[model samples]
Target chain A: MTERYVYMDHSATTAVDRSVLEAMLPYFSEEFGNPNSLHIWGRKARKAVNEAREKVAALVGADASEIIFTGGGSEADNLAIKGAAFARRDKGRHVITTAIEHHAVIDAFHWLEDQGFEVTVLPVDERAMVGISDLESAIRPDTILVSMMYANNEVGTFQPVAEAARICNDRGIIFHVDGVQAAGHIPFNVRDMGIDMLTMSAHKMYGPKGVGGLYIRKGVKIQPIVHGGGQERGLRSGTENTAGIVGFGAAADLASMRFTDGSIEEEVRLRDLLIDSVTSSIEDAYLTGHRTERLPFHASFCIGSLEGESMLLRLDAAGIGASSGSACTSGSLEPSYVLLAMGITHELAHGSLRFSLGKDTTREDIVYVAENLKKIVADLRALSPLWKNRG
Target chain B: MYTEKVMELFMNPKNAGRMEDPDGVGEVGNPRCGDIMKIYIKVKDERIVDISFETFGCASAIASSSMVTEMVKGLTLDEALAISNKDVVNALGGLPPQKIHCSLLAEEGIQAAIEDYRAKRKAGVEAKA
Candidate 1:
């Protein structure tokens, strides 16, 4: 029999779409030209970049001029946090963020702190949802920037984006969001939500890696962190990644189409099916993220007794690809900080598993994974010293 | 990261389970630390006749446990005690630096089990005296 490989690690990264690859192919070879050059070839390349910028902007309902291309999600996050922090330093030296943010945003805040900026890290509830009241109370006259993730990378919990934006707007604080995991999965208009700055990655949404964008709302004052020939309006300097940017544009365009074509709804259905199957069939399994207020295609859990890396290995052997935030997987001594912050015990946190479904996931694949996961969990638990009963 | 031999052992461990009515049992590591290994050994004629392990940890930990048990079975108690963490590591090709601790756990577990068995025999001898 042939091997059955099911990829459910979309949150980590996705397989680039065929259409996106096709769109990017020309720019890599024949159409390859310096976008800054004044020749005809340069003009063609420049036109492609402009069109890509428009497509990326349209994905988030931002104006094309408001979007600045960055190297990747991490770079976009750094640009937003550092750029805004430096620009508004004269106004205030205080910034705010949540405890469940990805390393990109959290480390940026840490760097800002080293540079003399005081940071207020807000706590989240058991479901990993940040409290709006916490945000309201954390805001001070000295607060200049508040960076929070739109959706958690580990648990997929959706933040109180609109409410946080409104609060920041009332306080005249520049609100930045790490939308790396949420951009194309969740539909949101940055302007309507008053989000001053948003970070997005191409690889998370079926685009090629090495390309990302930051949406800076009009009139939002932010300094440029990268210095060079002033490509991407000087916010980012260096030659633009022509082919990668084209791939990102194509991926975003496809995501826009999926949003309208009921494909996203179908993905939600598959996600729910996987969640229900795994949680119901496996004993001592608990869903980690908010059930309703999470990304439609993401499902994470903590299974008791067994560690995450072992589970991932067994699943991979069975041709199911996934990821985990367990200490073993990270090569760290501690389990996932997000789970620990959400009140999960250290023992349970070590058992964390994340399955992020994507456009290619199907019902049969989900069923096969669930069935195999049940057996895997049972088999692993049998070899667990912590497991007392066979069940 | 793990070697091919490590994955082979983890996929199909030589001796993996609990031994009911074992002469000695030893447990090491902690659940909070994300790795715990329990080893059981059956002794006869001063030799380890049977061995089994239950490990709640990453692939390296599981593989280490399996490799240690395979290395010790049918050996004299002294010979089994001489098997070091380095031996377990070498037997499994090699483990990642971060996972070296897992091999140490396997060594400690077997040594603990042997110690337990000796302690039981001493207790019985003292009781008879």
Candidate 2:
């Protein structure tokens, strides 16, 4: 029998929306010209690219000219962190960031350290929230930039980005926020947040893959890491991904409209339902992130004595898609660094599971997941010696 | 990435769970490293009469324990001890490179259980004399 499929891994990537796909069709065939060309075809492509820039910028409350499209969220984060660091090299060589940042930001800082730059990785609280005081103290006279994520991908905890931005602004330091996991799901304005630079991905918000953008607030100096066509106002240099850009624009516009119209309320409701059901029904199941200060569509937990890979496999067999932090899933013996940074034990971290909802998620799907997840966890725990020993 | 056989064994492992008043019990691996296998064996007339296992680990570890238990059932003590991790891996089709250690755990579990049984038998003989 064909089981019903329920997708609950939206934080990893979302399926492209029908409207976004429609917006991108013309750019691939009819208007398939490089924006740099002077011909009429080029003009059409360029207009579409420009219009996309406006739509993406509008979602974040930034000017169209300030948007720099890149290959994906990682590229956007690289440009913001490395670009800002190199641009302000004359002022300082020190950077401040949290230990919970994505590898895109963390690895960039590691590379900087190899080049003789100093980095201070601040620790987070148990809920994965970076303290504002720690951010303040990490700032030094030679500190040039601060890069922190808006929300954690694994635990779904929202950070105090606005407070961090304010702290950076007061210190005359460049601040970059990796908003890849937060942009579409949460309501936040870059201008009001006082963010100098922010990175977001299209694929995380019902748009096409391989297209994302960096929002550079006006007057923020950043050097281009990829030099070729002098595109993205010389910040990210490459030929435009016209079709992907159009889809991103459409996705952003739609997401913004939904946010305004309160359609995300349904997602929030479903997320909470899944969270409540799993935690309440499953023994030793513990929520990972902040109880309330989390993404509207994110629900994460660590079920006791059950390996995440086993749980994920059982869930997949039941026609449900989920993600985990188990060593088996990551192809490494260690658990997730984010969970470790939040002071979770190795055993608990190994059992971590994340279920991210999206626009397409339904109440019935949530109910099904809760029921199947309870059974899956129970089955796995039954075969687990550790679970039996605990009793 | 597991083979179909591995997945099958993992879903419904053979000879799983602890045995009451078993001749010997063996536990191997550590929970901190994310895998632990406990094996129980019942011996009669120097031949293995029954064997069972309980494992806490990923799919590969559980399947490895299950496969090893099935391989050693009704075998002599020496024959059971002769079974290697490679035999368990081969029995389950194959295991991923990273999961090779799980098969090793199964081999160690069987050895430990047999060793425990031998030690107990020797102690009983000494006490009788």
Candidate 3:
């Protein structure tokens, strides 16, 4: 079929890079050996896994031994949250995170709550930014860990992770960062940030899906979330995903090499063009994030009472592939919890759409989307009773 | 995905504006759901001869509202009332399952408009002949 759509939802998952895929083809068949097995084939596989570990470590500026491969970002988050909570239950039974955290982190914290941990959810400003002062205030004698994302997945707001880490370091608290959205797209140094634990996903960084890694600061002492043959230093268990790991490492290597590619600046430029064109042409349309300090590639907006689902469909038909919220929570009937937590009204919240640019996204693509979006929005408003009343 | 019917309505909307001076008007929904439809009707000899609409919402809601206005034009009040969401869906060819609610809301907007017209006419009769 003809390319009927231009994908603008890279915040969800990026297309697998051709280079990363080629690196994986060998591992799945030609070099098929269990890393745990004691053979030359197994040794090669183990060697690849270790190389991947080093590449992953280098991507985040951590020691190779600190990289613990997990199923994906969610599982890594579970490991960091639950493992740390249970392991330190005697020292302290409290955990702190933001209200706008991805469900992976939120649900893990919920599980900790079930196990009798005192969980404090920090609030964000209108831009979905959690305050460091609030983090300080939320800290207590029994707070064992502080978890926050390096950047928000939806609105693309950058969080002050280094500051949060600084505070955590001062208080001797474990600081875990959910960098699944921030990794690759933004520059992150685990050591420089003073993070005890961090999580990342492969697909978000142009690698194959279902593979991810965690950065475990040496001596953090987090118990394994799963039990099996001692793999990932016994933190994440089960037979390793060698092919996915290889792809992840290749992607991480590329991300590190190209982190400063002019593309991010270009994507941000296109993002602003789309936002400016869409909002200026459509009445009552408003951008929904910190105007200047948001993710370089993100554009989120609300257009009056127009339902987001319908607009998304119309925009899709018009050849623009965007998102209503985070792809992870797409079909849920609930409005965006991130926006709601940021104090956006429930009504405007439902009308929201998110457009994020990526490596291949171009100015022409953004312009085409913007022009068609204006038409689609205009037509929808013409049929809206609310628009009529306002007139 | 835009249902065939929804897209058709969006691309070629019917009755998508207010009557020059509508004898009846109806408003429904709010901006929160991203759809608010106001329908205006021109009644001649107790029949809707002209209809127009204004909507503010996402494309589907707007297109659906445009479709609703177009579908209701040149029909009697009772006939317009008989127009069901399924009928609108059928007209649009088909809507994505998630967008079935858009057709539902369109149906409600049409019904609400007719009801508003009836109340106005009834009040007019009580006050006069």
Candidate 4:
């Protein structure tokens, strides 16, 4: 592919690797027996499922039995937040989460709010971090759950999950994390983080889109979010997405293998290349999220006066596949609420672009995107009435 | 590349800032979406003799707001109110579909400012002559 053919929206989703595809293909054909059936074929399927479970467990330092397969990240997140909220509603009515959480956790909390539970949204700093003291002070006698993301999708800021977990654990509040963005890209161990529950989507890694898993620590009680068949230990009731699950396990196994390997360092190097290239080239461009405490695969920034949707469209027209803060929110015409919560103005947020790198990303891709971006920002700013030469 | 005319309006957008404490004021939305345009009118003999605008938005929004001020400068309130968004688009050549809303916002700002003026005029009439 040419320089223009760069794909920078890896945080949104990744292209499935050929190896991951090969690992999952057999399960769709020869190994098609239902894991719940009584026959020998069923037992084989069950054994494969268990092996896959162990792979996922090893990635997160948990027992194989603790992981529950769900349809996707949102469903898993809903099961964790809403299910746990309702199941423990009699015990307490308050749940705490950070302001920068994904919509899955945010919407689930909203649903709980509708059901008469109070939710406190903790604020983030300019670097998009929720302070541990703020979280600790926010906890009350009725606070039942404290859910925060491992890393933000847009800004790439990694929160103090271990610290948040410690606070929640000491206070007896159920701790959970939406680790969809952080699972494959960052080193994650549920036990080390002291998390009671967590959510991850396979698609966030290099796996299929519709498959995800929820980690419910042993003895964590959550009601069934989806009710039908008696599959997934009855927490999730439906025929498993077998092929997708196989692919997910393959992806998890690869991620586990690469955890301490140099892939993450290479990804971080690529991220730095994009960041430095853009910053050194473009004027009045500023980075969002934590400078050091960020995901190796994500970097987001705001260019002066140019709208993110238009920038994304221009970039796509140039053959690069990238998305933006404005394009992501889509209908509201509002700027990124995440950036807004960080005290950046709405206008600046609208002018932002999120450039996320992936497994196949290279230095050449970064240089190409940086060059095109400098040009686009210049052209857009030339037409902006509010744009003035800050340099 | 956008047309030279479109770029002209986008760059030099007339009346592209806010007017402080006019006899009337109008605000359409919170400034998070794109821009918030405020139009200021100075009326003479039931006609908009002098008009200006101050905008807090993107290039398209600022240009449209500026154009709206210029279009209504010497027209009767009735003519000004009849100025449709199509007229603004035609005047600026064309706007992208997303930016068409900016033109509509410009028109809305004009109408809102006029309404505020009329309400004040009504109060003046009820007071004496």
Per-model chain A TM = 0.99, 0.98, 0.96, 0.97
List lDDT for all candidates, in order.
0.94, 0.91, 0.82, 0.82
Give per-residue CA lDDT, model 2, range A91-120, as digits (tens): 999999899999999999999899888999
Q: Pairs clashing in candidate 4?
A: B17-B54, B17-B55, B18-B54, B35-B57
lDDT of 4 by residue, A1-391 (tens): 2345888898989887787899888888799988888898788788778887888777888898999998899999999998888888889999998899999999989988998999999999999999988998899999999899999988999999999998888888899899999997777789988999989889888988899999999998889978888788899998787888888888898887677779999998888888888877887799999877999989999876667765675676567877677632364677777988999887788778899998898888888888888887776554444566633
| Reference-based lDDT, residue A225, model 2 | 92
Is model 1 an incorrect, acceptable, medium or high docking prediction? high
Better TM-score candidate (2, 4): 2
Candidate 2 segments whose C-alpha is farther than 4 A from its true place: A389-391
What is the C-alpha lDDT profile of model 3 across A1-391, one tens digit per residue?
A: 2255788988988999999999999998899999999999999999999999899999889999999999999999999988888888899988999998999999999888888899999999998888888999999999999999988888888888999999999998999999998888777788988999999999998998999899999999898979988888999889999999999999998888777667667767788888889888788888987777777788889776566766777777677888885211255545788988999887778778888888888888888888877887776665555454335
Best first by DockQ, ranked:
1, 2, 3, 4
Tens digits of per-residue lDDT for model 4, B7-54:
677555665444455666666634456666667787777788777775
Candidate 2 C-alpha error for residue A225, in Å: 0.8
Chain B only: TM-score of model 2: 0.98
What TM-score does each of the candidates earn? 0.98, 0.98, 0.91, 0.81
Look at candidate 1 and give me any clashing residue pairs.
Answer: none
State the local distance difference test value for candidate 4: 0.82
Error of 4 at A379 (Å): 0.7
Error of 1 at A122 (Å): 0.8
